[model samples]
Target chain A: MTPISFPDPDFIARQTAKMLLEVKAVHFRSDEPYKLTSGLVSPVYIDCRRLISYPRLRAALMDFATATILRQVGFESLDAVAGGETAGIPFAAWIAERMGLPMQYVRKKPKGFGRDAQIEGVLSEGDRVLLVEDLTTDGGSKVKFAEALRTAGANVTDAIVIFFYDIFPDTREALAKHDLRLHYLATWRDVLAAAREGNHFPPETLAAVEEFLNDPLAWSGANGGVDRISV
Target chain B: MFDQLLECLNEQGAGVRAYDACARMARARVSEEPDNAAAYLLLAYVAQRFVESYDDQPLSVEAASEEFQQFTDIVKMLDKAEADASADARIAALNVVAAKLNTAPKTGD
Candidate 1:
């Protein structure tokens, strides 16, 4: 039998960023500016949901996700892989298959009642569960999912996302406050760098994106968007 | 529950297929079965499609806003339905889209 091998973190990050661009999952419209449901106006938007359509790219990313989990947290660290609500279910299922672990999903709200109302699969008490999400910004949803897991008596210390906005300075601190170690494959920084290398967009657009990435909140505020993010 | 919805949908028959009729049927379903998100989604779809029926018309700015707001009231329930992680919500969303297309008056290409 041959041992499984994985790409280094930098290589994985670059590949993940490049794939996101290839699939057109990342959008930058600084001039038009999109209004998020959160009421913030932003120059950037990402739809990780689109990844599900591209089987090859999605498979590669899931492999990278499995590698990241194993390398960072060790092979024996997780008893189950749980997805966060809607978008996270498929990603968690794929990763759970790769890791050969039990799979579960945390609902946004409890269905009826009971200790595990928010949980779908059979999660043993004290099982170490890693919550998976397609992407996260300020870690608000992660906190809620982690809290739900704790309420159901699962041991959750780490959460992984396919993409992390990373522009928010308080995201890590917020997750840590709840004792969840945030792990992810790529971020907007990697996507910007990949865009630069590929000359994907015109120089002006890339430059504008870089400026926003450097100090996102200030740029957003200057552009008539929210300057500060809560949670 | 959807069997009953399908029968009510069929009773509408061909012709004008009024949005008012769709709303009335959906409301009746809600009264009979309170937790019918699909009924609301289907009704909302009918309203959106009703708006689409006026696409190429010379609707004034004021008229267009009024037409849109008429259906917008039914849209808030959509988030409550979409946010649900259960298979029931997923299936409901899918079924309503298909059902809406079947019943909605074809407006454009």
Candidate 2:
């Protein structure tokens, strides 16, 4: 297996979006908008976790991830790789293999007891850790995972995700306050561009999406969704 | 020294010997270049050798835990190493051994 070889960033984003679409990872519902756990109503949803079930697609994406991280973060910059539990674990495992690095998975909450309960495997003090996750909505969960790694004696200065919502402006700021750098393959805008180029949705639906992206709060309020994000 | 190391590894068990040899080589490689994070991983590979062959031995669960801990520490530092494709391959092979070691029970009980 080659150390690092796959899609470039642009190509990765395009193909990743395509893969998501191909696998029906993308969901669209205009009439009955689905309400997120956070109480935000959305016309679309994406499930990245399902990517693991497809071996060939998962393999290609992981190759892209390994190549991207090596090129951008330096092959040796990370001391260890941590995957946010559940969804991120498999991706982390494949990428860890590609990079030939030790792998650990972080829990959403502490397991049973003890400080290390939130962590699995071994991590050393001041280890330059890289956090891996499937997707980021508002970059909220990434901070929580980074904190867990830090508390466990890891130096989590960077994170990688397959997708980023990138709709909220403060997502980067929230990450910055905790000294976390976010790297991702694709974002909402990328998906939007792809949707336009591919004509996946009708013009009206595309226009609605554009309106939402331009000003989510205003569009949400107009569409009987939450006027302001709470959190 | 090479012969001595080999003999020491064998008497201790091939698994242990492989672990020690890999660790030794990794350390030596890293000393030649401090930026070499791959050495740390090589150490894990060495540990993995013991893990792979652990099933054949009669080690206590406690003893196995200690050995597993040592191996895990190597994986923990794998990413920080300087890039060396050959070393990375070697480390990956060791990880395969390590994973097998993780599942292999001490007494098959």
Candidate 3:
């Protein structure tokens, strides 16, 4: 498919947000905050893992992801697709199929001895790897996975995630610092807009979520969560 | 193991021929009792041809995974056999293909 034939980015974002909500991937609660892995308490919690459970939604999401990557990165740019650990595995698998490229998964830690320790599946040295994951929060995990791919002799310059936190300022910079381009289908802002437009939650809850999104560290600090994000 | 992987890769590289072979093998194996893992692995190896030969219209990863699991089971069974070195090497090659297939993407879609 040609790049322009793809759905508009704005439209994709809105629809992706709606799909996430429809599948109950996004949860909003003001009274009881959800604790993040980073130890941040927030009114909104998103579990992209749920995306794998819905076939229709998963297909649409993969289409959007495939389109975005194709638009941002050339269709022939990638040689292989690598999924990070458990959660990223399925998404990576889908992307690899869409791209019709060989697929592999990177373990969080080395599986055995040698340089290819963290890698599973056959990875040709110097082959370009497009890392895939379900979502990115601080983007830390993607960086870690990309590094592993690089260490295993993969030229990992691009990564795709179904969702990106988009709240953290350093997320993109951290990715760029590692020479990785991050491609995502939807983000926190997109979810927030969809939530507001759909009235998925109370106005106050949406506002609180918006506030948390606007200044997450400050909001988390005030809300009895970690103020500083450890690199 | 490398030789079989190369064979699978060659079959994938062969385009329509691989697809026809895989389709024929898949149908043939369907009538067999309990399904042979080798048959499934062969199907998956051939399915990669359809995936590669065609563009945009993606093969169902679910279909790919079924053959992949079959291939993996065959490898596991061979590993348990504790056969001679040549048989073990042959199993090893098949397992490489199986491992590749086992990681085949799941659409869940």
Better of 2 and 3 by lDDT: 3
Question: Rank by TM-score, descending?
Answer: 1, 3, 2
Full ranking by DockQ: 1, 3, 2
- Tell me the docking grade of candidate 1: incorrect
TM-score of every prediction relative to native: 0.68, 0.65, 0.66
Candidate 1 per-residue lDDT over residues A49-110, each given as its tens digit = 89999999998999899989988888999999999988899999999999889999999768
The TM-scores of chain A alone, one per candidate, are 0.95, 0.93, 0.95
In the range B3-107, model 1's lDDT, one tens digit per residue, is 333333223321122233455566666566656655555664664465345321222223333433433433433444556757677566656556545864444
Q: List, residue by residue over A49-74, the lDDT tens digit for candidate 2.
A: 78988999988888888878887888
Top-lDDT candidate index = 1
Instruction: Give the range where candidate 2 chain A is weakest over 10 consecutive residues by summed lDDT.
Output: A32-41
Alpha-carbon runs more than 4 Å astray in model 1: A1-3, B1-109
For residue A216, give model 1's deviation from the true position in Å: 1.5
lDDT of 3 by residue, B1-109 (tens): 2123324423342223234444555545446523245634554554544444331122223333343345445435444443444665655755665565567543431
Clashes of each: 0, 3, 2
